[model samples]
Target: MFRVLVLILAFVANPSRAAAAPPDVDLELVLAVDTSGSIDIGEARVQRLGYLETLRHPDFINAVKSGYLGRIAIGYFEWGGKVNESSVVAWQVIEDAKDAEAFAAKLEARPIATRHGTSISSAIRFGTRLIETNAYFGARRILDLSGDGFNNTGLPIAVARNDALARGIVINGLVILIRPTVSTVPLERYYAECVIGGPGSFMIPVRNVEDFASAVRQKLLLEVGGLTPSLTAQPAAMHAPVDCRVGEKYPSFVEPAFRN
Candidate 1:
């Protein structure tokens, strides 16, 4: 019995018996898609299809292949007022076309849903937690947040964004402009000033329905390659600064009549 106890103690103290280190990857990306009430079933379908196609595209595949580690870890989740476990797709490592296909298939199989509220802050917080807790160490951590409207619930946007940024997570935006909102502030301008940050951060505005897929594909390629678009291709500089707190200050702005 003494010998057995000694053996057990030795095993417990052994470094090798400790939890294994997470794998290293070129990037750890969380695709926080918006499924807020403003996004109708058709729009939700389009968003999902856009991501599915982008994941399988040659350009995105090539970008992943060219990474320093020749691999990336990606996760997908839908967000609105808040997040739930059911809406999150697990992380997957992509090193080749087959891996990418499998990841896309997982997202495709999940049912598209739209929850109430436009809580961009909550999405950012959730994305940060996912990256922090995932089983991979990435050279770069990014949260690619796509949304049609401003944040109307949860913590302040800047607070959540700053927290993520402090932890070295880059936030990029896919600003959907197809829906008209009560705010006169251009969604692109709002995202640029208040949403996106960190190295090589940028936002692409989808002004028309036809541009949705291409915008998503382009953003993914840039993110996978860790490259920022040229100055001319980025959103134009705003002559007037936008009030980042506009959404929170006017909760009524998220009402059905004002939503996209």
Candidate 2:
């Protein structure tokens, strides 16, 4: 009787520990989309559509079911500036076309929120928090951050990247380079050096808006299957190494104009 009472008291003291374990999936993916001031309305819409179509793609559904567990968990969020991260969709499992279609519908129905400034660092931290709180456990944790501009606010991105990597999160990036006129260094290079980290982390750059869909499809496959795309398949612009400090240097040229 005393042992039963002690066990009951222990369960009561730590209810979370006694709670049912989260469902296990092959991958826990957080799609952290950028809605910073630089993104603008048309570009933002393109990004949203890119994601929607990718989610609804037959190949993506196949990739989800190819795993041992035959399922993956996903969440969506938008981020910009400090304190502007918003979860667009809660964690959900994807095992078949129906689940993927439902997730796509949610994306289609979401209203976009406009925010100012770019804070990739904050987005990374937000992804980390989502991974920590999600009700599904995945063999792999991946944060897919899509952005067009450098990190201009919040903590340094390298710090956040290192922290997330330390916690076993793989950070990948979809570098939106449609506005090359606004960038001093290649956006893909920025993502490769300062943003993405962890085993098999990679960045896919899309120069033309039309390529967004295919790039996302391929990126999703690579992530879900834990397969690396051939280096030869990478865009020609990424062949040369780039300076990692380019993101840090961007504000020195752009911030003064914003202040004025």
Candidate 3:
């Protein structure tokens, strides 16, 4: 009994484990993709392919190399409910074509899975935590959110968005206007006013299926280079007034998988 107690005490006293120091990079980006039930399998496939192509695209690689450090850390995650944030790919350093190809290959190996609800706020919070714990120190940390619907579960998005902004983390959006006709409030407006924040934060709405690849490439360029795309030439409605709480009007039927 004394020997067992001594062993327990030793274990408690020396509980520390060595951890690698975080490396420095130009940017740390979390690609938070939506996998809510609203997005069908076909749509999900398109999104996956779009990201894979963007990762391997020459334009994106050039943008990455344009940075002073010529490298960036990136991670891919699928978000839906408060607890349904799944990591599709871990953080990877992209310094050249070979590194980018390896990252794309990892993404392609993951099985596409969908969750039950749309929790944009949860995604933001999850992404912020990821940035905090990653093995890289980025000059600019960014959360690139891509989603079709609005927040229907988890904490309020405004709170999460504000928290992230307060930490100097930029949150951008890729508003996939998959069902513009069905939604009363234009999603682009919702994303502009409520979703995105921090310096150089902006969103590009993809209205047509064919434009996904081009828009993604452009978005990646902006993100990697820390450049804000000019929105002055866009339609007035794209910057129109919005009700951030519009999504709250819907009944909450989905329970979070993380919270029992």
Write model 2 residue lDDT over 15-89, tens digit each, in one string.
Answer: 443355433677889999888887788878888888888888888888888876789999998987853534468
TM-score ranking of the models = 1, 3, 2
Write one digit per residue (lDDT tens) for candidate 1, span 195-217. Answer: 99987899988888778799999
lDDT of candidate 3?
Answer: 0.78
Candidate 1 vs candidate 3, TM-score winner: 1
Clashing pairs in 3: none
Best by TM-score: 1
Give the TM-score comparing model 1 with the true structure, all chains together.
0.84
Regarding TM-score, does 2 or 3 come out ahead?
A: 3
TM for every model, in the order presented, reads 0.84, 0.80, 0.82
What is residue 243's positional error in candidate 1, in angstroms?
2.4
Report clashes for each candidate as comma-separated counts. Answer: 0, 0, 0
Tens digits of per-residue lDDT, candidate 3, 1-260, equal 64344333223322221122223577889999888887778888888889999999998899999876789999988877643534558999999999999999999988887878888988988888887678776667899999888786777777788878766678999998866636687677788888998777899988877888888888989999879887677455434467777776343553333210
lDDT of each prediction vs. the true structure? 0.82, 0.77, 0.78
Off by over 4 Å in 2: 1-23, 83-87, 181-184, 233-260
